[model samples]
Target: MNSSPSVKIVSKCFVKPKTILEESKKPYYLSPWDFAMLSVHYIQKGLLFQKPLHSTDTLLDKLRESLAIALVHFYPLAGRLSAQINENTKSYSVFVDCSNSPGAGFIYATSEAVNHDGRTMSLLTVQVTELVDGIFIGLSINHAMGDGTSFWNFFSAWSEIFQAQESNKTDELYLKNPPVLKRYIPQGYGPLFSLPYSHPDEFIRTYESPILKERIFCFSSETIRLLKAKINQVCGTTSISSFQSLTAVIWRCITRARRLPIERETSCRLAADNRGRMYPPLPRDYFGNCLSALRTAAKAGVLLENDLGWAALKVHQAVADHTSEKVTIMIDQWLKSPFIYHIDRLFEPMSVMMGSSPRFDKYGCEFGMGKALTLRSGYAHKFDGKVSAYPGREGGGSIDLEVCLVPQFMEALESDEEFMSLVYF
Candidate 1:
């Protein structure tokens, strides 16, 4: 780790805002699945710091304070989720812990580290191995919170504040009081957000014992681009984005590998940032959860029948409903739901769920060491599988992906030649 003087700087900024929403006072409810996801990230904590610094405490304190401030405006949801879960089920607390171990102490090592036993919430954690010279900051956040894009917004603001302090500049960035949810009319005639509680008698089955799990193969950027181009050619349209293409491919692979029936519709959830797409980019640096879920239908044969291009187009149209107004309305409705009703379960019948966003870049997380080697989701205990992709370096015209899936399904995909060709192209 390279030591730098900027690491010594620390700010005394603090905010104590009062909670306004009733949900703010409630505890977070973690269903049996939620608890499983949170447990997977328990041991994967730590961020690396390579910048030359005088003391680790100073840097950590500054980073924590910066994150806290960035998160202040979005306070109501901050402690609310955890509070709600604890009220109904057994509660667990997420704390920030730091250590300076050799080799594995850096964020680079910890960020990609996964718990084979699937007992932790986040697969990656900030290590901050060497603070005196080189600085590494490992960030590990639960997937339930906003996606990578949202995380980067909060991270960039932290970096900006840190840079200002290092140069002896006064802090000009301050969060406004009572963060408001930009209001908008929702699409469709149904409620903004609702969960189906009545399970069919046939849906009941004997409980299957939990099994140990591991994240499958690491995807490269080159193959992702090929898949996108191929999808475009087949679909005969360019309106679809690379994200849509890759998601379709993954959804297809998972369904086929799992032997899911074609007629059986799978519900896949994609994460969307209701920012610039909204009336105005909701405070570029506004922290807290500024995300909404866009649900898409996952038909098993969709990818096999069409090329990558066609899949991409289909995905784009399927998810078009997730607009800024739709997201705001969804959040409002979720907050208003009864404590006994677990809202996330509404998508359970869909068989699978997927989420992705471009927020990872905004982290501005360069601590002088270098850009983070990898970024991925914390863990998915509820859904059957989850995939998160970020833009790659060098404008590779491809996106880097981090995927979480059932171990058996991942193994079968890895051994299949066709899937490998599409993934690595």
Candidate 2:
């Protein structure tokens, strides 16, 4: 790693947007945490090595050229959003900050051994606090734009552009016509409708709670596959995939640890990306959020009443239901409703959690040197969180997981033999 002095410059292009101010109704209501999340890159920093010598200006020019291509689809990076709410209306502004920084304020270095994986993963590290390095880059869109899958597709496109690769393959997957946002008047009048109880401020305050994360030791892919096969053998069902089996086992383990009454009920929130699943499959390159949540509930009685095989079957069915068109439509409706207006409030009281699978592998984020040795989100939010398994640096089928949970739960899980067996085995 090389060190360099910070550079600060002012450019008219970086100014804030008027839309943001109008929508927030407050000139300065932007959340620092949100802004930081939006701005952070997946690969915080990178090491690059080349033949002779290249001027810093040349590198900067190359970076700018690539960014312009990337910004064509990801317009959000080009500007910041502001909101304004008053008696007559709620408006937002999108201001562009034209100011320049002392350039990419950070040190630059290269090593002969540092391998360049091509342009897609060759982005240099973004300079942020060391603590924030491991977290995922969160973008807070209007929720009106699209879903998580759409966002992933966009990132893939941007990656292709950065690599100077053809985007035709990705373009074919997205909708030919861009999505149009539908406008609706809130049934209730006044600023009350605009003010979500769980405001952006609260989100920033409790974003890093310990209860939101938990650590599970890595497991070998072979072991996971074996476990899946064993589960299938016991259940006599070939339809269930390894991911479904693992999810079932995880759910059961968490339930046992919590020791809720056998009759009590609990739910796990699962996110599904609707890219390839859509009729005219969404563009694999469309950038924006295209994620939807599916809730799976288990009554303590139902779990305890059945053997592991039966429980796994139940979990499988629940997950299947989530992928149904009906479920997708329902989720779409909810996201666009008034209830979503207070989403921040709902997240706080809810025991919502996530279990991402397979998708982690696709984040193949490389910025010249090579794919990231590790990829993780910056901080644990209010909800309990976990990423799906990914290949470890060692090159075996080992699984790498990042989890956030309450401190107490974490302590218990760390020492619990049963939990360890499930996680490690």
Candidate 3:
């Protein structure tokens, strides 16, 4: 697995819409939050399969064919982003022009990437690696297109259609359950052009930050159990969840590694999904971004001095604050002041953003193949203080954290005795 695998491009093409799907050429407004992601390129998601195919053409054709079918329903992914201004308000907003463009980019690659540790090692970096018996598929979608939930909704649908095609069944049911594209925003919500901007051109300019070291840390079920038990013991309570416990430990370790002043405020920004928390719950198939970030902060001294339970309590409380009433109030706040959404964080110093959910069964995404051997974020995400978690391939309530941090802090974190004791590479 350590050897550098060779990857060769076999074909490059666009998986255009299956039919001349007609719609109003009107643009879908990018929510205030969606504007923040404009400068960011598509988020890369990947899947590894071990199914033996008769030929590379067989796999590529199946993928392109199923993608065309999937895009028929999730057409926005097939479109491009453009900035539009409201003449009367003299303000601007971003929108997706869903008119038939050349569909999503499709690449077929052949590689010799190795598989180990229950999954393919660094397969995402390899475009197409051919082993004796398997192939890997990589997918990219603009972040403005949707958040993880929406992205996965499309992924699940695509997987369903692929499976149906294999079984000679029609995927009309999937097409019928199309994503709801009407953005649910409070009336009179204006363009988010007024948000604080450290860099005024950020929306136009791509985010380019200093190089970051990416590492994958795996926490076993047994390690998590011990950590949770220790946190519960510290608080004399057993209510703290595994996520809160892990976040608490990682945040503390990261802070200590930076060697920041103990008096400085250190905060963890966690995204709370609002799909089911709204007054009228959004459809399970609701597409696009519906995330609200909650910042839990404490003096570095408090975090460093206290046990993990203290940090867990703060995380728990921050999450608890997102009740239906709070969600409604939040919508009102964003409508009244769109600038409150923080896009400036992209250019600012490192602050953690956690994504992916163990609740989502990534391991179960079948595509005619038996099952995915491994699933991961496609790129070595270089954003400062970005952390994404996925259910471990080992499948015993374990978690794998993809951490992107500055090299110094990464070295410090890797060497930290307490942190390393609970983590495996």
Model number with the top TM-score:
3
Tens-digit per-residue lDDT, 234-312, candidate 2: 9898877766666666666666656668767766555666555554455654444344555667686687567767767
List TM-scores for all candidates, in order: 0.59, 0.61, 0.82
* Reference-based lDDT, each prediction: 0.44, 0.41, 0.67
**Clashes (N, CA, C under 3 Å) per candidate:** 68, 87, 3
Over 107-202, each residue of candidate 1 has an lDDT whose tens digit, in order, gives 323332222212232322333444344554544444333334544554555466556555555255552223342322233422222222232121
| Candidates, ranked, TM-score | 3, 2, 1
Candidate 3, poorest ten consecutive residues by summed lDDT: 114-123
For 171-202, candidate 3 gives per-residue lDDT tens digits of: 45445457887666555664333333333343
TM-score of 2: 0.61
Instruction: In candidate 3, list every pair of residues with a backbone clash.
Output: 111-128, 111-129, 111-130
How does model 3 fare in lDDT? 0.67
* CA deviation > 4 Å runs, candidate 2: 1-65, 82-86, 89-213, 276-281, 331-336, 341-352, 360-363, 380-382, 385-398, 422-425
> lDDT at 372 for candidate 2?
43
Q: What is the lDDT ranking, best to worst?
A: 3, 1, 2
Instruction: Give the distance in Å from residue 263's predicted Cα in candidate 2 to where it truly belongs.
Output: 3.1
